[model samples]
Target: MLRIILLAVALCLGPIAGAAQQTVDQPSSTIAVEDSAERDAAIAVRIRNILAELEGYEDVTVAVTSGIVTLRGTTVDQALAERLTGLVARVENVVAIENEVRQTTDVVEQLDPAVERFLDRFRQFVTYLPLALVALTAFVLVVSLGFVIARMKRPWDRLAPNPFIADLYRQVVRLAFVIAGLVVALDILNASALLSTILGAAGIVGLAIGFAVRDTVENFIASIMLSIRQPFRPNDTVEIEGDIGKVIRLTSRATILLSFDGNHIRIPNATVFKSRIVNYSRNDERRFVVDLGVAYDTDLVEAQALALETVRNLPFVLKAPAPSVWIEALGDSAVTLRVAAWIAQRETSHPAARGEAYRLCLAAMNAAGIEMPGPTYTIIGAPASAPQQAASPAPAPRQPAKAPQNQDLEAQDVGVQAEDELDEMISQERQEQADHDLLSSAAPEE
Candidate 1:
């Protein structure tokens, strides 16, 4: 034990004593009265002492004669060799310095110093192990505390508008704690200045990533906005960029829709946020139009009146905003008329109401002997083999199809309500991704 103690003490004090070892003793004051030989000896001793305290100078030898100093032997490199001159010149009474030191080329000689440096660093690391451990423990504790706070759900959920936003909040909290922990660790290690270097590098990397994924970043931001201010709610019937569908849910990366044909359509949130959206379900009452053409020879006034009466009498058509009928345009062989009426689309489908109105109007027109002719073509010149002078008799009155006896003028709710298959599909999709879905039906529409 005594020997071990002695060895440990030596290990601690060995290099320090070697560095502190007395240099060649200098002469006393009253150097002004000394001769050139005395002053030269003093200068040599002073330069020698300075070199003794430093590394890579053990091979150097210093000499002074007539107030002129000369440094001899080898050092680590030419730069250190040049440094000896400035060091020697600072000594009292030294007139000039000659740097005669050369950098050693011997492999063993060079490797010796490098090995010593490595050993010295290893010793320093060993000495700091306990303190480094303490700093590491502190960092871990701080980061763990942050994770605990971030894992909490109630606060994040209450603060955010939707699940996606709540998850974002948690991630932000975790990241903030990580940075705080880093700062605390660096401060404990007495390396706080290094924190700026770490953050700078992180910023540079983050900027590069942002540029590489500009579109993704845009979609993320759009998702946030969408989650906050819900442009359209779940199950809303909307037409976007000519694709009509019921909204399923909004996710961080895309807006999902259940198309009419039951296929899933995924559009990037960036595009959805930028495109024009036409929401058909915003109002309960919707108007539908159906076009019919009557032969030009038929009375346009009577055709319009009969069609208007037929549509207004239908059970589904709204009476307040009365049904309207008007001449739309003149076709090649007929006069086109447009019939429009309003219905409560929630109860009656727009397509069903429009088709029923068309069928009934055609029946009424045919029953009244009003001809709705097909497209007809005529040649200006006379026919080669047809008779020249012939006055054709008026066409026979057209007969209508078997009407529903008394109520044949109108069709009941046969196909009034459209199938709810798309709505069911949208509900199923929303359930599948409820965790990431940003949409909320209760949220006020934008």
Candidate 2:
């Protein structure tokens, strides 16, 4: 056990002794050593004078022997202590340096330097106060001029198509002028280099905010484009993406619509801009069709002529384009005939006119003994041996309907006029929210 203990102790001491030996005998690579003691004393005095002339090194003491210099004492911080080795090496005939300076623990030593720095900064600020004041005044004046110009509403309102677009123009003008003010102030202060930093920071913040509100930005841009190009006017009946309604107003973020059923719908401007739009109110004339089927054995020529005459005699049908009837297809039980007619859509309700025309035409054909049969099926393979039971009384035959006389069907009040209720609602909405609406009736439509 004693032999093992002795071996471990020897192993640990061996590396330590070797390391110390190598450190102590390391040769200086910088300068040749001097033999004279007087030269060493002179070197120490010169280093002390150099330390005294510089700040943060007052407590540092220097000693020299045989061309070697040793630095001892403390500094306020490690950075200053580490800086001493490079400064002392620049001295003449210094072979090597032992930098023993350390960070000081005394609070007064640290506080004194901070107070001296503050006082020095104060003196420089007092000297340059007049120039700083001039720069500040220039900045304020420039910014105030920008504000003054932005507040004038005439130019922006005239340039923009609507209030929403006008507000955007004013905002852009204000931003541009603010940037100009910053540039002028920075130039006056001789700090134009800082402009790049400020702008770069602003760009990063703006990019992040843009991503955060991407939908809102898209909607705003769409509103600007829509306001410029006036797709539809107030009270125009349109179908957008499948939603059929009358246009109520255009807003910054949304397009408001009043549906035919008197329900309000709000769609985002982005969706509206990208969707396919069908403006029914843009054209005064619209075509409606009524499909009727007659018995396959019936003469197609006579059926077409009868349908055309029935649709043409309707009071709401436009006479210039006239009415048309054609054999559409051979249906399962009859021949389908498509009858189409043009109408003044604004004056006539399309659905009501179509329903009334279908009723009158079918009655006229039935009264003329033209059969219109529904689908029929014949059951086969029934056994005659099936049981027979007493039958219930048969239902009475339905009476054939008669076609109305020309005088009776020629009235204008026969459910063909368009409804005005939804139009009234939309007009009221537009009146109450006129300030926010971007659409104008007098503007040319696209």
Candidate 3:
């Protein structure tokens, strides 16, 4: 054992002694590094101190060559070690970082294609940060437009920006700006020409779509026209195709209404454009005509005066325009009278005022004892035109002297026989006439 120990000692010291001898024999030019031994030792000591400081940190190691640094160890995360190396590089006298730290996980096994693609896309996005900023700006502009549109209109101002129009404008302008932003983003990425190519290909398809949806396109155009012309606005009461409702909202396809029963109605914009619209609120004043017919014998003056008073008393009726009454026409049973009145602010309470006028006028006519005419018919049967007869008829000329006729039975027998013969002849003639009348009644009339 002692022999083996000596042999091992000699083996270890042999290379050291030889190296010392070589250093003494060789010229200084043979050494690659020019720094003095003291300066090298000082640098080594400084690096050792830094390594000692980092020793407490898990999975970290430090090494130094000359003024250069090398980090080596099995690191939990290689990225963290790399970042540490960069941080150390920022410190003074760190000539370079070797970054020899090895990741605990196999790097080749961790690099999946999808992860590589993600990294590539991340790099691209960083490269095109300006495009991303423009997209953000577009979002901000759209939101700002919405705010401006909402606040632009004041409800009471007659000429204030209409909310619907302003909102539409904002939407269109914002959409245009966003599209422009997208175009610019595509251009920055050198892909704007791809969009033009896609559009060129889609042009054919778009023509087919246009033909298929021609009616829809027409309605869209009509909606645009309606928005521009603004024939009617929100909150206006209108009658279209016999449907009357308050306008609530207008959209590209339809106009929404709130019916009297609180049901939501969506009438197609095309229907609106086609139908007749009576805008009751368009004019501040409206003319209302009420027709009343009274019995022919009723006093015309009383009827006219009562109608005029009733119309004048209506709250919505305009006093300046003045109510007017006219005798319209004379009919079979009654005379027609018309009452015309002008109404101001007609939208406020139209039906109520008109109903009140009708009721009050009827009541006034009733108070004045004016008879209102109703339907009547005259029967033209025989009883209505038949003549009357007297009870005795002048004693019929005192008929003649059949005196002493029955000078006994002779006179009575002779008179009875003559009367019987006359009665028989009369009965035969009457039966013939009755048969003729029956035949005539059964025949078809020409």
Ranking by lDDT: 2, 1, 3
- State the lDDT of candidate 1 residue by residue for 1-446, as single tens digits: 99999999999998777645522122222225445787788878888889899988999998887766777899876788877766665567766566789999988988997899899999999999998999899889988998999899899988877788888888988899889988888888899999999999999999999999999899899888878878887877888888888888888898888887878888888888889988888888889998988887889899999999888888888997888988999988789999999998777877778888888887887787788777765548678897777777856654423434344664868343344766766677677767878887666667
Better lDDT candidate (1, 2): 2
- The order by descending TM-score is 1, 2, 3
Q: Pick the candidate with the highest lDDT.
A: 2
Stretches of candidate 3 exceeding 4 Å from the true structure:
1-197, 346-348, 378-446
Cα deviation of 384 in candidate 2 (Å)? Answer: 10
Backbone clash pairs in model 3 (N, Cα, C under 3 Å; residues 3+ apart or in different chains), count: 1
Per-residue CA lDDT of candidate 2, range 80-199, in tens?
Answer: 888887777777777767888999999999899899999999999998899889888888888888888888989988887777777887888888888898898889889999999999
Between candidates 1 and 3, name the one with more favorable TM-score. 1
How far does residue 388 in candidate 3 sit from its true spot (Å)? 19
Look at candidate 3 and tell me the lDDT of residue 235: 50
In model 2, the worst 10-residue window by lDDT is: 407-416
State how far residue 164 of model 3 sits from its true place (Å): 6.1
- In model 3, which range of ten residues has the least summed lDDT? 405-414
CA error at residue 185 for candidate 2, angstroms = 1.2
Clashing pairs in 2: none
